[model samples]
Target: MTPIRPLPSYLVQRFHGWRATTYQENRAWYRRLAESGQHPRAMVISCCDSRVHVTSIFGADEGEFFIHRNIANLVPPYNPDGGYHGTSAAVEYAVTSLGVAHIVVLGHSSCGGVKGCHDMCRGLAPELDEKTSFVGRWMDILRPGFQKVAHLPDGEILRALEMQAVLTSLENLLTFPFVRTAVEADRLTLHGLWSDTGEGLLETYDPARGLFHPV
Candidate 1:
């Protein structure tokens, strides 16, 4: 097989600098983690958005959170059909293997994936309507969510859809028997969260109120 090219010099140099400084400064902690292995208490399912920094927002340290990122942080309902399912595999491992106590579905404001789904559903983005589009298929998980908010005013639709993404993920997570069992047995808890990139605010979903409240 042909060998792949190395990373850019600047990135390599930056990594070396981090290894010499941050790694050196936290050598003992890193060593401990390496020896003990990770046993993170929570699993965070978040969007693959550069602006949404899970660690920075929660001030989480290494090995503190088991994170899974996807286009829209959407969780597909459990389907045991012997197919390739990355998200389901991660959730299974987190629940059965790691025994994570919490599973948090985190969405954020100004999500390109959410916007794309909105556009595609509105017939505004014909490109995403193609069967060959991976993003479109992934965003299909959030279509039910879109239907719920489609009646809202155009201006208020985006934010509502963002929160819906979180809620939808939380709802889908329960489709996994492991997740449902853990939740019912009080071994695990499910949470939904949304972040406002512009306002630098976090909001949490309240199942009782069926609404998101500022955190």
Candidate 2:
């Protein structure tokens, strides 16, 4: 068996620092959380972008949110083929087990995943078209979104497509039977949001208007 090496020195040092300060300062709180277990109010589906900090944005404490992040922050249409589906598994658990009251799909500007989808659709990036490319296959979830924005000017598609990711995820989420049942029973609600990372701006989707308005 391969031996597991010690953590990187920087991470070890950081852990030590956190253990001395933040962990110590909140030891009792941490212990209480451990004993109580988590009962987060919302399940946040967000992008894998390191810059998109979920907890910081909402001022949520530890265990307050069940966050699932992936490339482009996508949630594929519910498919029960007995195949591996990490995102779907997370959603199922959050809705059926955790009983989260809300599900939030959060997208962001300047997303590399969005750009990759755009480029791939336009034939600007062939590598992403290969079946062996995990990213290409995953980005297929957003191809419909591209079709929605394809008619717009080149400068507008990226941001528009970014918002489409949030919308697409929200739509796909309902394809799950558990999620659909919960929503119909008024036990769960879904939301879509997009953030401009550089501008620190936020916008929310309004189904009534079918547009994203800044907040």
TM-score of each: 0.97, 0.97
* Model 2 misplaced regions, further than 4 Å: 1-4
Tens-place lDDT per residue, model 1, 173-205, is: 999999999999999999999999889999999
Q: Write the per-residue lDDT of candidate 2 for residues 125-159, one digit (tens) a residue.
A: 99999999999999999999999999999899999
Candidate 1 backbone collisions, by pair: none
Per-candidate Cα lDDT values, in order, are 0.95, 0.96
Clashes of 1: 0
Model 2 root mean square deviation, Cα atoms? 1.4
